[model samples]
Target: MLRLYESSGRKISARIALGWEPSEVFECNLLEEDRCPVSIQGNEINAAFGAYEIKSYYLRK
Candidate 1:
């Protein structure tokens, strides 16, 4: 299983989906580090995780 969350955490998006419900989100463990690969706009940190493939749309403030 995998966990997914919006920028602010809401019901609009799925906080936790299947390991690869849409075949996009997946849980990966590197050595002793676990990553979910969450995509955040304008953030380069996520780029390294391939989060750039997924786009999070801000519906409201």
Candidate 2:
């Protein structure tokens, strides 16, 4: 899991992509302090891997 924060103090939304897949996915929940909301976009980081491609996405803030 990754933690994101709004250091610029700006309220914004974005789609974050990762290059690997995890057991669990993010759903952009704002329950913790100093932590931004993010969601898992996908697990297709590269096309080199046949079907085991690992990737993720999350909202920055």
Candidate 3:
């Protein structure tokens, strides 16, 4: 599980490196209601975050 937090009061872009390629990626939420699929390019995940936003991702090999 990888968690990202944007504490800055501005939108930001990020690139997360997992080192290894993941076969599947899912976006995790607090409610755990549904597992939203996330796109992975190579061994990295690129995302944009809003101010004070928090995001969690689950990667599976």
Candidate 4:
């Protein structure tokens, strides 16, 4: 899991990939708390090439 946060400490988002599944997509509100259960919203993302494919998102300030 990759954690992303805003500079003002207001919002956060995490990215994680489990295997190569073309049918999977996700999104969610950025959460700072580690112990709390985080809920993520699902969005459309695409990946090509098989095996250990890396997916990344960029956070803009």
Q: Which residue pairs collide in model 1, if any?
A: none
lDDT against the true structure, each candidate: 0.31, 0.38, 0.88, 0.33
**Which run of 10 residues does model 3 get worst, by summed lDDT?**
26-35
RMSD of 1: 14.4
TM-scores for every predicted model: 0.17, 0.39, 0.87, 0.20
Evaluate model 1: give its TM-score. 0.17
Looking at model 2, report the run of 10 residues with the lowest lDDT sum: 44-53
**Candidate achieving the largest TM-score:** 3
Model 1 lowest lDDT segment of ten:
43-52
Which scores higher on lDDT, 1 or 2?
A: 2
Against the true structure, candidate 3 reaches a TM-score of: 0.87
For 1-61, candidate 3 gives per-residue lDDT tens digits of 7888999889999999987999998998965547899899989999999999988888899
Per residue, candidate 2 scores C-alpha lDDT tens digits across 1-61 of: 4544444444444444566654344333344334433333454221111232232224332
**Which candidate model has the greater TM-score, 2 or 4?**
2
- The candidate that achieves the highest lDDT relative to the unseen native structure: 3
Alpha carbon deviation, residue 1, candidate 3 (Å): 0.9
Ranking 1 against 4 by TM-score, winner: 4
